[model samples]
Target: MIIGKVIGNVWATRKEESLNGMKLMVVRRLDTESGCEQESFVAVDCVGAGIGERVLVTTGSSARMALDNPNKPVDATIVGIIDEVEVRAEG
Candidate 1:
């Protein structure tokens, strides 16, 4: 799983039939330790995540599982909207 922030939306009028109803968003990867934003990528939204919200993303085969469809042709999917993130310093 990857922690990211929804930065924007993706509008594809012509896409695969299986992805017709899927909401796609651009999610910028977040560095848990430094709170830095990294590269962004499009991900299918399964949890109704909106722009600016922090989200949890699943990728690869697991991403397909999040949608409950293995043939959705998606490499990434937003599985959860994050409420908060707390990182503690290891002693």
Candidate 2:
């Protein structure tokens, strides 16, 4: 899973038949604590995440599996909305 923030949304009137009813969002991956930039990618919002919301994104085959619908035609899917993150760093 990837922790990221929703930066924007996407709209397409005409899309692939398998992607008919999916909500799309632009997500930028973040660092563990500082929230530094990592990468950005478009993802399907399965959890109804909005802009500025911190979300949990699943990528690749795991994403497709999360949907439990093999024909969804999604490469990435937002699985959860993160409220907080706890990390322990050892030097």
Candidate 3:
């Protein structure tokens, strides 16, 4: 699982049967404290996350497992919406 922020959204009128009702959003990783956005990627919204919200993401095989059918073709999926994050610094 990866901690990320939903930076934007994706719209597609036509798609595969397995992905017909899935919502797609763009996610960018952020620095724990500063919230500085990093690399961005598109992910299928399985948990109804909106833009500007921190989200938990699952990738690869784990991503498929989050969906109804594990065999579906999906690379990334939003697993949860984060309410808060606590960061601990190492001295």
Candidate 4:
């Protein structure tokens, strides 16, 4: 899973039939250790994550499994909304 932050939303009036009711969100990948932001991408929102919230994202075939459909044409999916993150520094 990749750690990211919800930056915005995606609204597509017409989409694949299998994705009719799925909520889409824009997420920017975050460097958990340095707190730096990276590339932003679209993801299917499985949890009720909103803008500015930290989230857990699953990509590739695993993302399809999260939605219980392997043919949904989704490459990324938000699986959880993170309340907090604790990173330990290496010695």
Candidate 5:
């Protein structure tokens, strides 16, 4: 799982057949401790997450499970809309 912020939306007129009714959003991974920005990627959103909201993203095969479709061609999906996040760092 990755902690990220929803940055924007993605609309595609043509895509894989399995992704016909899915809502895709742009997510920017965030460093929990330093609050730094990391890689950004498009994710399938099924939890009704909105822009500027923190969300939990699952990638790879697990993303397919998040969509409840084992064969969906999704690489990333939003599993949850994060309510809050707290992290502990050790140096």
Candidate 6:
């Protein structure tokens, strides 16, 4: 899973049939070591996450599974809304 911050939403009235009713949002990844915002990309949101909130994103095949639509063309999915994160430096 990747940690990201919800940046915005994607509204597409015309989309693939399999992607209908999906709530897509823009998420910016946070650097694992510094926890700073990185590149931003769109992702399907299954957890009703809103902008400015930190979220856990899953990618690849698992992303499709998160929505229970294995056949859907989902490369990324928001699986959880994160409350906090704590990373320890390597010993």
Question: TM-score for all predictions?
Answer: 0.93, 0.89, 0.87, 0.92, 0.91, 0.90
RMSD after CA superposition, every candidate = 1.1, 1.5, 1.6, 1.2, 1.4, 1.3
- Candidate 1 lDDT score at position 79: 92
lDDT against true structure, model 2: 0.89
Supply the TM-score for candidate 4.
0.92
Number of the top candidate by TM-score?
1
Question: TM-score of model 1 relative to the true fold?
Answer: 0.93
Candidate 1 accuracy as lDDT: 0.91
Candidate 5 lDDT by residue in tens digits, 18-37: 88889989999998778799
After superposition, the stretches of candidate 6 with alpha carbons farther than 4 Å from their true spots are none
TM-score of 5: 0.91
Between candidates 1 and 2, the TM-score winner:
1
Pitting candidate 4 against candidate 6, the one with the higher lDDT is: 4
Question: Which ten residues in a row are the worst by lDDT in model 4?
Answer: 82-91
Q: What is the Cα-based lDDT of residue 68 in candidate 4? A: 68
> Tens-digit lDDT track for model 3 on 1-91?
7889998888888787888878889999877788877888989999989988999999988899888888878999999999888887772
Q: Residues 6-71, candidate 1, lDDT per residue (tens digit)?
A: 999999999889999889899999997888989999999998888899999999988999876788
| CA shift of 34, model 4, Å | 1.1
Q: Predictions ranked by TM-score, top down?
A: 1, 4, 5, 6, 2, 3
lDDT of 2 by residue, 1-91 (tens): 8899999988999889778777889999999788898889999998889899999999997888777586677889999999889886762
Report the candidate with higher TM-score, 2 versus 4. 4
Which residue segments of model 1 deviate by more than 4 Å? none
**Weakest 10 consecutive residues of candidate 5 by summed lDDT:** 82-91
- Deviation in angstroms for 91 in model 5? 8.4
lDDT of 4 at 76: 97
